[model samples]
Target: MNSIFKRTYSYWFLLPAAIIYFIIFILPTIMSFFFSMTRWTLSDWEFIGFENFITFFQEQSLSIGFKNTLIYAVVTCTLKVALGLLLGVLLTSKIRTKSYLRSVIFFPTLVSTIAVGIAFSMMMHPTQGVINTALAAIGIDGPDWLGDTRIALLSVAMVDVWKGLGFATVIYIAGILSIPAEYYEALQIDGGNSWHKFWNIIVPLSRPATNSVIILAFIGGLRSFDLVWAMTKGGPGFTTDLIASIIYKQYQGGFYGLATAGNVILFLVVTALAFPLYTYLNRKEVDL
Candidate 1:
């Protein structure tokens, strides 16, 4: 009777969260799958199996969006991991004003992303922006940052790294701090320098944190829309259009079914890539 009562109480505690998840996630997912197979408007939907997917793949911009999203995810993830680890090591060192510097670096992450995008758009203006002004002072010409098709996507990606690296650094700091100090002491006793300590100890022990940062940042990059939209609006000839931006454009143009199909594809891509990478990284963590 006691065991039965405990089991009943445990289920009661889980019921609310289960219901909420179903309502928020599962229901929308099911509806999206249904809608993806139809031509949907506000009040009417017609069954059109696989047409949306076919159209999506046939679109020129969709291919560009997929390619850009893959590149953005890979580049941003690599830079964030590399730069964040460097920043973590520096900030965790016995340098003065380290905490103040950390706060300053992290301040951008707390600001609204749209606001950041707008502000950066202005700053990157070729003629009147502060970046160009500073470049002029140094006798260097700054290219049209967001307006130039050649460099627009990369410019936006750099901003993303700047905004997100602080959080990644903080996660690294936490991971590094949680490691036992004795390892460093032992390394020092054996005459290991900073390079040896970092490569041999810090990197190995921080694998879990690095894994988390990579997955989160990669997903964020893959789904990035707001900043790219506000900054470039997928403009200068679709050079900066990511998959999320393309999907948003579809929705805005009243292609609800097509947009739904894109969303489902994005979901599946993230899940498929993230799960395998996550499992592989976790296994590496255990090995380490």
Candidate 2:
């Protein structure tokens, strides 16, 4: 009985944090669920069943939002995994300026998302932007990055990769560095070259890092809003409309219930996609 009491007291240390979690996250989520089913103002709410949800789905740009959200998540996640691994391996190798290079690569990540978006938006301008100006100097015409319907999402995805690659590379670096030195030494004794070392050891062992990068990048891409808003506001005819952005637009239009419904849908969608993905990736990690 005394031991159990001691253990209970030990667990009490988590009470404050748990209470904070309940108030900050659990409470708001519950409120969102409730408010999502209502037509509400500051003073009162009228329950409307699932009408808000139905109207949310009936939105003209919902399809585009879903499409763009998926594409953005997939593209950014893939690029971050591949490019990050490549950079990680390179940076982990014997190089004099490795520390400086690592810092340089990570610099963009430390910048504000909105700032990066705004800066890139200006840089990607069709005519006078630095990117286009440099392209013209090289006798190439750069397309309108943010204004184009087709490539706008891709452009934003690329910027996301640029911003996120550093964190992914850092994860990979930690994974690679954690590998036993004897593994490389044994491979060398077995007449294994650098490619063998990387392929047999680094790629396989670093998969945990890859999985982390994929999951984080995918979720972040799905929830991406500020950058898109700052850059194009889901413009160019919904080319880069993401679920989060659509919710913001709804809120902006003063349809609070509809917006909340969209938020709930987004939460459900992310939960649906993320859990399966996480489970599958973790299973792969275990298999590996």
Candidate 3:
């Protein structure tokens, strides 16, 4: 009876969370599949077979959105991993102002993203913005940031990396801290310098954290909407339009079914890529 009671209690402990997950995640996802096959509005929906998906793929904006989304995800994820690792090493180093510098670097992640977007928009303003103003002072011209199609996506991506790098750095710090100090002490005993310690000890032991950061950042970049929308609205002739932005525009235009289909596609793309990549990374981690 005591054993039975313990099992019951364990199940009860999990009940609330399981129910919440079903209600919030599983239910909505299942419903989305249904909605993706129908034309829907607030009060009404009608079955439309695969028409929504067909239209979504054929839409001109979607083509650009797909391309931009992939590019943005790849670029931002790479920079965040590379730069975050660098910053993590710096913060963990025995340097003056290390604690203060870590806080300063992390402050941007705590601020409101929309506020960051707006502030950066103004800062990158061609004529009077601080970035261009500095360039002008150096006798160089700054390109129109969000206004120019060529660089608008890259500009948004840079902001994303800035906003997210701190979180990645924190993750790396945790990973690095978890490493046994004996490893570093041994390296020191071997007369290894800082660069040698980093290359041989820190990099090898931090694989798990790197994998986590890469997957999370890549997924976030793929689904990014708010900052891009606030900064460019996928504008300057659809140059910066990501998949999420395109879906949002469709929803705004009352193409409910098509928007649902777009969401479905986004879900599939993220899941498909993320799962395989996660498995590969975990395998590599085990090998490490």
Number of backbone-clashing residue pairs for each candidate, in the order shown: 0, 0, 0
Q: What is the per-residue lDDT of model 3 for residues 1-288, given as tens digits with 9 covering 90 to 100?
A: 999889877788888999999999999899999999999995899998988888877877777887898999999999999998999998888899988988887889999888999999999998999999999999999999989988999999999999998899999998888888998899989999989998999998999999999999999999999999888888888999988988899999998888888899899889998999999999899333
Better of 2 and 3 by lDDT: 3
Considering only N, C-alpha and C atoms within 3 Å, which residue pairs clash in candidate 1?
none
Cα lDDT, all candidates: 0.90, 0.89, 0.90
Error of 1 at 274 (Å): 0.7
Pairing residues by index, what is the TM-score of model 1? 0.95
User: Distance (Å) between predicted and true CA of 111, model 2?
Assistant: 0.9
Compared with the true structure, model 3 gives a TM-score of 0.93
Candidate 2's displacement at residue 210, Å, is 1.1
Q: Candidate 1: lDDT of 212?
A: 90
lDDT of 2 by residue, 1-288 (tens): 999989878968998999999999999898999999999774789999999877766766765787788888889888999999999999999999999999999999999999999999999999999999999999998999988888999998888888889999999999889887988989989999999988999999888888898899889988989888888889898888898998898888887887888889889889999999999999889333
Flag the better candidate by TM-score, 1 or 3: 1
Q: Once superposed on the true structure, which residue ranges of model 1 sit more than 4 Å away at CA?
A: 1-4, 7-10, 286-288
Give, for candidate 3, the lowest lDDT window spanning 10 residues. 279-288
**By lDDT: ranked, best first:** 3, 1, 2
Model 2 pairs whose backbones collide: none
